[model samples]
Target: MKDRRRFSRVPFKTEVEVLFERRRLAAKNLKDISLKGLYVVAPERPPVGEICQVKVKLTGAEPPVELIFTGEVVRHGPDGFAIVVTETDLESFAHLRKLLSYNLADPEKIEAELGRLIR
Candidate 1:
């Protein structure tokens, strides 16, 4: 199958809390993340096309802020579900950018992908 990914993903295991509709779901296994989305390993998977809010708390941030991301559920399997990022606040975006930069060997690749997405 042809790969349809826009941005490269990196391992970013962390605590993830998702607000699915009016229900709150928590997962400890956040498999990976890209500039565009998240892959969460959980017991429950929301239906495809459902929009959800994902939050990742930053323990190191001096003021303490969580990276909030709003995205649509694109795929789900027995192990986990995938979300395609649709919205993010400025602060969260900055935090995500920095996290990806720190994890990726070639940080510029993520930036280039962001540029392409913007255009």
Candidate 2:
């Protein structure tokens, strides 16, 4: 089967905190992440198109990295919901880059995958 994903996603497991209406926060497990978005495993799925703030604390790094961003719920199913990231800072981008670099081998493959995302 052909993979239709734009950006290459690496399998990542981490705890993610999502804030929805009324500043209520829910903790969920993050399944995977790409440059564009992430997948969160949640029993109570949020409505599609709903926007929420997400905080992901990535450990195992030298000093750890915290990624805080706003995203929209693009898909929801039995497994979990997918979030399309809307906003992020430079620090988050750097951390994501580092994570991908560590997880993904072959620089040529990474270049090709990222090139597909641009086009």
Candidate 3:
């Protein structure tokens, strides 16, 4: 199948908490995150199209930071589920950029993508 992703994915692995249907699920992640969304592997998967909250714990920040996104479940498969990000707070957005910038080969490319994202 053709990849429809607009943003480049960064290989990131960490513990992520998925909140859906008023229940919080702990996921041991094999995560690949982008500016747009993330892939999460959890035992209990949220249904497609379900609106949920995802909190990705950034393990090594000075104090600590959780990159939180309010997103929709867009796909489900054996690997787990894919969430398409709808919204995030300003701090989370900033941290997300930093994380992606650190991981991706061309930091400026992501910044360029961010500019395109606005329109």
Candidate 4:
């Protein structure tokens, strides 16, 4: 069972198509993602603490999100390797959070803004 707080792992597996340092390749069946880091199930394990950029597409969202950040390899397994994202492009992450049912202070804020615009 994965924890649901702090470093909350996503429910479904994802696909991380990566472009790293002039090299373009795709990893299959990404496991989980969180604010702290993401776990990628990859066969070709990069060296531990090696920083690499990754692009992951969340399920049910149009246009795959591009993540240009550094990741360090933490562990390697027979089926895949686990990577810890060192840095993240939070700008995109924030936007995605909004799309994924993020709570707004007031749901009618948008309507209030629109009302002001009309007046």
Candidate 5:
């Protein structure tokens, strides 16, 4: 099958907290991330198209920046679910960009990927 993803995803294992309802939160492992989305490894799968808030703490950073974003459940499977980020704060986007740059071997590749997505 052809890959339909808009951005290239890199393996990123980290803690993620998903809030789908009021006073309810689920802690899961972030399996991977791209500029547009991320995959959360959790047993409880939310229905597709559901909008939720996700918070990811970047532990590799010095102060461990926490990124908060709104995302929609795009795909689901036995292991976990994939969320397409719909909104993010400026600081959160900056942190995510930094994290991706640190994890990827070639930063230019990400630039190219983003370029492709924009076009």
Candidate 6:
């Protein structure tokens, strides 16, 4: 299949601290993250088409940068669901990209790897 998404996906299992509507919730792990959205393996799946705010607290970061995105649950399951951010917060997205780029070990190497995968 031809990959159409304009985002590179890194397959890494990381535990993330998620917050929705000021409510603390736990997801299984992060499935993938792009400039547009994030997929998580959460057991407690939210209803599809429900719009909510999400904040992801990632490890290896000094302080948690709140990611304010208006996303709707697109998929529902026991494992997890897919959520696409309706609006792109440039500031938050840049912060997240920087954070991920730092922990990626080698930015150039990973980007090349993802490029191959995407192609």
Better of 2 and 5 by lDDT: 5
Best by lDDT: 3
lDDT of 2 at 65: 72
Who is ahead in lDDT, 2 or 6?
2
What would the per-residue lDDT of candidate 2 be over residues 1-119, giving only the tens digit for each residue? 99878777888998888887756556557888888899988887778999998889888766867888889999996888999988888888777777887887654566676576558
- Arranged by lDDT with the best first, the candidates are 3, 1, 5, 2, 6, 4
Candidate 1 stretches greater than 4 Å from native = 62-64
Better of 1 and 3 by lDDT: 3
* Candidate closest to the true structure, highest TM-score: 3
lDDT of 5 by residue, 35-103 (tens): 899999998877899899999987876888899999999999778999999999989987887778878
Ranking by TM-score: 3, 1, 5, 2, 6, 4
Tell me the number of clashing residue pairs for each predicted model. 0, 0, 0, 0, 0, 0
Q: After superposition, how far is residue 106 of candidate 6 from its true place, in Å?
A: 9.5
TM-score of 1: 0.92
Tens digits of per-residue lDDT, candidate 3, 3-110, equal 966799999999899999999988989479999999998767899999999999988977878999999999997879999999999999999999999999999989
TM-score-superior candidate, 4 or 5:
5
lDDT of 3: 0.91
Q: Per-residue lDDT of 1-119 in model 1, one digit per residue for the tens? A: 99988898999878899998899989988999999988999999888999999998767768876899999999997899999999999989998999999899999998898898789
The parts of candidate 5 lying over 4 Å away from their true place are: 116-119
Model 3 vs. true fold: TM = 0.94
TM-score of each: 0.92, 0.84, 0.94, 0.62, 0.89, 0.65
Candidate 6 error regions (>4 Å): 15-24, 100-119
Please give the distance, in angstroms, between residue 71's alpha carbon in candidate 4 and its true position after superposition: 1.5
| 4 or 6, greater by TM-score | 6
Model 3 residue 39 CA deviation in Å = 0.3
Tens-digit lDDT string for candidate 6 (1-119)? 99776555556556654556567666658787765568878777767787766666555567745556677778776678778777647787677667557656566654664465446
